[model samples]
Target: MSEQSVLFVEDDEALRFATVQALELAGLSVRAFAGAEAALAALPTDFDGVIVSDIRMPRIDGLQLLARVRALDKDLPVILVTGHGDVPMAVAALRDGAFDFLTKPFATDHLVAAIARALERRALVIENRRLRAALAAGETDSPLIGESAAMVRLRGAIERLATADLDVLVEGETGTGKELAALLLHRLGPRRARPFVAVDCTTLSEDGGAADLFGHAADSVAHTRLSRVGAVVASSGGTLLLDAVDDLSPAIQAALLRVIEEREVQPIGAERAEAVNLRVVATSRGDLAAAAAAGRFRGDLYHRLAITRLHLPPLREREHDRMLLFAAFVDQAREALARPDHAIGEAERHHVLAHGWPGNVRELRNYAFACVLAADDAPGEDRQDLPSRVAEFETRVIVDALRASAGNVVKAVELLGIPRKTLYYKLGRYGIDPDAFRRQGT
Candidate 1:
């Protein structure tokens, strides 16, 4: 295991010595600073450690240091040590973005627990930063390939929204590149340097109604009895992409609304809420208005999330973009498989253009990969027939998944192991009736 570092700041000599001794004994590398100024001067933005400081230090106190730290790294965890009477001050420190506070004269166990929590918070910050960096380097342009009017307009919207700090709600059919659009927005925005945390709300449900957006406290309890930090608390100073927000239960929706409204997240086991600066972006294939009307989603939350909505047009509507996207996917497939350039034959292009891509861009990419694999396998046969085989394989997978689920849309969705909306979109693409099984009373 890697060693955890801690920066301990306390004006009291005896208390500082005892605290450093305790931390060191707990297997932490301690950097003790007698005053806040000394600690603040040495702590840079790249310092990945927990900051334990007294709330009532002499010059440039804990709050000021916290403010300075926030300016440099918003996710750094700062634990404030306060006297018994300084509860109000501790609360103020929390509002000013302190991770957590411990009252003075507390037991060593209490202090150690606080430090452990701070370290956990620091680790999350580092992870989030790394993820954001990867996203920035990987996705700068619209992932959807097309030159049709709808595609042009969609890309324009993404470009325009990328410049602002506002929340975005992406509405599109399955495989319409909702995640891709979200990634483009994050890369294009000011918070590109920060993290982009994506959550699949559909997979997180407790008892069919209560869903854990952040992990449960009960799940985090251990033999040592320390509570682990949850995902919502982990993603600070960045974007949190909640996929399938439509699937979230009403209880989870209410909790989410509180986080967005307060700009803070209360971890499952923590007594206090940690202040966070997050840009929220939600995606859904269902009509949010209908969900709200049915009381499945909160009305206020819907309004809050839909501040700016971007709709992605389906593949059929973007006919002009299809050829461009197909060519782009072909090039990408070749590069991905380390194969030489292979042209799309005239017959293959005709078939591709004539057949409606119900799976949208993602479906096309899969087909392209299959074509490349097929071409590689054929030593002397005509490579031009590879596209048709790829298409056939794609169709087979779709049909098999549908058949396994007995035509039950929801069950088929589970069998396909894709998003509910994506499964529905594929059914539509293949001209399968979603309610066919229900109509037959099967």
Candidate 2:
């Protein structure tokens, strides 16, 4: 996801306001202007964001702004909005390097999808430019590779909250890189040199768990005669990451709450409580508050750990990032296997992009490894990378849309944001039985 702001220039106040609101709601930072002159005045020559403008605006129009933008930065993306009569003009702007053109009265989906793709392209351009500069300076950086809007916002959120010194609660589905976000938080914060201790609650035992967390001296418990170093004490002056905190036993939760409240840990068998100066970062794939309300988790603990929360969007909801991530994973896999010739084809790209990726990044990583091996060693027709994967994904989407709309064809079309004719063609092309979904919906 691109965090770069979008510059929206439209003379129509109502359209500008509505579009701006939609874009912002879609997680874009927007700068809306009444006309080209105002937008141009505000646009810095080194602006990193994409420009979206109406072509028929008064005085200096969008094309004029596009020309000026080209003079400043030829690579800067300029998307133009055009009326029915301005199609010719909008088409001509493509020759002059306009990123894309959207017709007036286009559906919200049309505009949004276009803007998202454009921003993803803009992010690549900016990243490439940065890489060029870095290479010239003999520097290198590892970027979290994703171009989807969800990823863009995730990166932005991490950067913004990294320095805030707030205890963070990260929530996401399994394999959504919750721990990765926590690592970034620690890496980018004041505690870079400190220990980042991660404990999987699922691995904690009821017998030894509490002792492992709060530390234990010999003779404190029936488990052992030897003293133990717990995560809380071990993580002092650093961060204690609780992976899957929802699995933390209620007794442990209460103890954790005390640590947050008192800024200290009470080690078992110790006469006095020990002072602790540490940050807590906890991750959960479950609905923690609901679990607390359901008597499965502690409410006070929930509130304490949720000082600053970050939710990582699942891969299915990350849109075009699927392809981006798959490519990165493929590159990693190829490099690991010492086969630089192993590359993803267009069919594989389509399949990756269309896949639901139920297991998120982990699943994608495995698929990337599999694809690399198969494409490298397997004979022609025996390879697994094919259009069948794309077809299956398409079928799933279509079936879900049909189920969502019940037996209503028009509603299904609207749900999928596709034209009625196109929907029918896909239904026939996939040989989908929409009646099955209609019955399921009923």
Maximum-lDDT candidate: 2
Indicate which candidate wins on TM-score.
2
Error of 1 at 190 (Å): 0.9
Clashing residue pairs in candidate 1 are 146-321, 147-321
Work out the TM-score per prediction.
0.52, 0.55
Q: Write the per-residue lDDT of candidate 2 for residues 1-442, one digit (tens) a residue.
A: 4468899999999999999988888888999999888888898856778899998878999889999999988878888887532434644776677877765665667677778767766665565455334434532132455656677777889888888888999999999899988999989989889999999999888777998789988888885798888899898878889999999887888888999889988888888888998889999998888888998998889999998899988888887566656766766787898865554554566677788888998898999898888775654421323344335435645665676678578887876666789888988998877787778777
lDDT per residue, candidate 1, 215-251, as tens digits? Answer: 4454434453545545565567778898988988777
Model 2: per-residue Cα lDDT at residue 224: 73
Model 2 residue pairs with clashes = 1-147, 1-148, 1-152
lDDT of 1: 0.73
TM-score of 1: 0.52
**What's the C-alpha lDDT at position 213 in model 2?**
89
lDDT of 2 at 396: 49
